[model samples]
Target chain A: MGRTADYTNERCSVAATLEVVGDPWTLLILRDAFAGVKRFEQWQDRLGVARNVLAARLKTLVSHGVMETRRYSERPPRHEYWLTEKGLALSPVLLTMAEWGDRHVYGRDKSPVLFRHKTCGCAFHPVLACEACGQVVDRRDIERAGPQDLTAPTVGEALDAVKIAAE
Target chain B: MGRTADYTNERCSVAATLEVVGDPWTLLILRDAFAGVKRFEQWQDRLGVARNVLAARLKTLVSHGVMETRRYSERPPRHEYWLTEKGLALSPVLLTMAEWGDRHVYGRDKSPVLFRHKTCGCAFHPVLACEACGQVVDRRDIERAGPQDLTAPTVGEALDAVKIAAE
Candidate 1:
């Protein structure tokens, strides 16, 4: 059974972002958007998603301002979904996810879809780089400048006393 | 009512990855993994997730090979979770998601957690770049180097045939 997941009570941004676009369907629709996909029919055909589900997802995206509907055909009342600046910002999230899937899930060069750099004509992946040095960063090179206490053990002192029963 | 979502039948890497770590709790766990939190107790304490729920999430991660458990205390039989090579590769995904959440959800400099580059003594954000040129790439600058056809309009020509019904 699908679970009813919500992070609204959490103050974390990831939780908040997930609240809006965390669903696989929503992410998939956004993936299509990066491909310049527009129109209700286009998303339905590409994703093979049910019509109502697709419509609901699109509506959610629009309400969140990740996407907007523009009238493409006046007489026909046809509209197309377009990514807003906020939506466009999701490219990295999608790209990095695809890359992870490509590397770990599909193996190198096996995934069907690829993002190519226009300037270099080379296939590129997302890199986490330092803004000051432009050097690629690894976990070992970074530290948490936390505004919250991630170190405090919240389970209680009684649990901490259980080191004698350890495992 | 909650709905079950699955992309198992899809060939997409993103979909495949989602099948493994798509749940909000699962991602939050991974985010904690990147932060160097290893013990079950640490995750439980930090996330405030239900014990059974956190246990289940940790089990899923371990079974998927994203994480591994190591015996840490011999007398107590204590164990700790650590990221595997495959799991470490997920840092970019977590980082990027956090960046997106910070920028769009919480606004700049407001996220309680910030990743600071130790080398540069500066806060850094994830950027997608070309491997060859190393310059930042945008959607308009790059085109899909597809091994698949994303340009195909799927909803049937009869609907698109309504161009005469212009909006």
Candidate 2:
């Protein structure tokens, strides 16, 4: 299942995003790419993923505009994969996942890698906040706007039409 | 593949996290669960996923302690899935993905659903920030500690050993 597995008609943004980077191998590849592992053989050696699957994933990511290939050497015509602007934007997603694993999977004392904020020189964890008020938001702090029914008529219009029909 | 597909030998936190909820369908099912779609039938209806796949995903989530099943109806013995504390902690990961999609996949002008911070009554976008300094941390503003090699000896001992070997 490549790009065709996308939930194209789904009205959810998360679903849309998952369609692009939802698979484990893809996510691992992206993680490795962020860690400066660019060569195809390096990724294969690092991830232990099958060559065909890696090739397909690289192709899918490139097609999705998440990554781009560049030729570094002309002798053997070697190409390396690099994250595009869109792909770099996924850093937070991966960071949050690692943080979650650090907290839940491995105890806090045994984190594999620590993320330090260069500005503050303090090791820190990522948090979701209200961009407007800068308040840390949790599931309870957030509310969904409305039902995401793309097939249904707008609620207000539907209600008005029903009222008119009754009248 | 189910839980057996996990990269258990990999010491990376991100890889550990991926082992839990890496598949596209599992992520979609978790998305639906976060949206308060608890009933099995509701997940089936919302995701349009095959029954067997949905069952496997739900079972994996339960085994991983991300979700739990509750007896919702005693008459028909119906059960509903609910996110555990560990699962709810994944909100940031999901929210980040949605925000990325809102920016890159779907234009900002046409978001499917909006997330509002109930505490401040303001719409919010999730951002990755340093928990200590409360500053937004970009990829350049952060540094990875070191290679997450499980096989590596302790850093201090390994360095001493390397020096001894060199001597």
Error of 1 at B50 (Å): 3.5
| Model 1 CA deviation exceeding 4 Å by range | A1-3, A149-167, B1-3, B74-77, B149-167
Give stretches of model 2 more than 4 Å off: A1-6, A149-167, B1-5, B149-167
Summarize candidate 2's per-residue lDDT along B1-167 as a digit string, tens digits: 24324476677667767777877678788888887888888988877888888898899888778998999789978888899998999989899988887766665624578877888887768777788888766779998656565663332333234336536
TM-score of each predicted structure versus truth: 0.81, 0.85
True lDDT of residue A59, candidate 2: 92
lDDT of 2 at A141: 85
The true-versus-predicted C-alpha distance at residue B137 of model 1, in Å, is 2.7
**Candidate 1 chain B worst ten-residue window by lDDT:** B153-162
TM-score of 1: 0.81
- Candidate 2 i-RMS: 6.6
